[model samples]
Target: MDIRRWALDSDFKVTLTRPRFTDGLLLVLLIAITILSPRLLPVRSEGDTVLVRAGESVFRIPLEENGPHRVTGPLGEAVIMVRDGEAWLENTPCPLKICEAMGPVRRAGDVILCLPNRIYIRVEGREQTDAVSR
Candidate 1:
């Protein structure tokens, strides 16, 4: 007979909960990954490693070495030199020697590519980034 009054008279206490890890196993995994992130990250180069990719193959050389290095690609050989603080493509056997014309690249991310030779060259450590976003 007094249904509305009965329902409205009831007092309730509401409680809040602190955020917690829903999955213990996942929480442990996340902790482990965070702890290992430093070692697992790609080694940051200081423009010290010169990388060359020729078709299916990749090669690396130290920029600190003051001398010329040669990498043979599909077309022929590309010669690169490293000096006091820079590295450059000396020559490439491709038709235009286009790779050689790229000039010296001292900064990281700088690249020289020869399409005919399937050769790609880049300096590592030119710039250090925590992560790349696309």
Candidate 2:
């Protein structure tokens, strides 16, 4: 019943707080969500011919064989050549040659992005025949 006695009790000590188990569980759940969200979401495939946009610049690359080609704009223009079942950047106006470093990409999920020129080359999968298309 005495306020002073209650305040001085060992149970009322401020520094004696124990870590709650729920806090650890919540932290683990947050990490799991972060790791799984991207994998769970549907991603656009590169098999279908699509325009890849990096910033304002857009490049249209085909998904078929000899389909993927590089495009150059007014500042500098170059086209990628695909021959003998290989792809390579034939030319570029940029001085750093960073796009050339990307080399050849054959897979359906590859991308070549030039940040300076705002150009993106994406390899997408071909669309399958479905009732909607028909």
Candidate 3:
């Protein structure tokens, strides 16, 4: 009856396992996403189209055409500027002028709103690549 010696001399052993095929596949996917992230993901200033809505009118403007544009709304007139591939709310009749301070927008789905004036400036177009990307 040598129970203490039998317990201390047990033959059980633990071994480490090698990585499985799924683990390798997951690692490859992660690396691919990391490398292609800049191109695949949407950016804030990657579009070249602009849309301005004032009252019942919708005006479509191209970002490449640099100039100041105007729109009329309930409160009066609003000015939008397009320059260097970007568009911004330059002036508005609303009391606070919040829309004018909203700064430039150059990406699809970007919008500047002047609730008091009943006007909005939006960017609506496909994502455009820069000259370098071409």
Candidate 4:
């Protein structure tokens, strides 16, 4: 039997095998893990703090403190201001300065990143169901 003749034969048929019981069980296990992973992980306690990172330095500032806190990065100074339970980037030495336009962050997990200056700012608190609702 020549390989080409067999491949081109008129009686040739191609079919997909049905999934076995073990395969179905594996799929169900995967779905369960995906649904439960987030709940299984420990949730951090809610806090009124903001975590700021610039280059090698890190600062934890309370959201209740209303002031412009400055941190230096590779480029220059980056000012993060906290007022009325919200934190935002007031100024950045980065070229684009897009981080400043991100608006205020009051809810937990909100982040303002300035990649050009290597700055990262995050608001810390209890996890919210979603960003839009929070």
Backbone clash count for every predicted candidate, in the order shown: 3, 9, 0, 0
Which scores higher on TM-score, 2 or 3? 3
For residues 1-134, what per-residue lDDT tens digits would candidate 2 score against the true structure?
86557768857744446778998899999999999987666543335454566456665645444644656554566666564444556567767878779887554556565666556665555422221321
Query: Local distance difference test, per candidate?
Result: 0.75, 0.60, 0.79, 0.83
Per-prediction TM-score to the true structure, in the order listed: 0.57, 0.44, 0.61, 0.60
Q: Model 1, residue 91: what's the lDDT?
A: 71
Give the CA lDDT, 0 to 100, for residue 124 in model 1.
82
**For model 2, which pairs clash?**
46-123, 46-124, 46-125, 47-124, 47-125, 47-126, 48-124, 48-125, 48-126
User: Model 1 over residues 10-128: C-alpha lDDT tens digits?
Assistant: 67433445656776678899999999987787654447777888778887878888898887788777777889857777677778876677788766776777789887778888365
lDDT for 58 in candidate 1 is 84
Please rank every candidate by lDDT, starting with the best. 4, 3, 1, 2
Q: Which candidate ranks first by TM-score, i.e. highest? A: 3
TM-score of 2: 0.44
Point out the higher-scoring one by lDDT: 1 or 3. 3
RMSD over all Cα atoms, model 1: 13.8
Q: What is the lDDT of residue 12 in candidate 1?
A: 45
Runs in model 2 deviating more than 4 A are 1-59, 63-70, 84-86, 126-134
Candidate order, TM-score descending: 3, 4, 1, 2
How many residue pairs in model 2 have overlapping backbones? 9
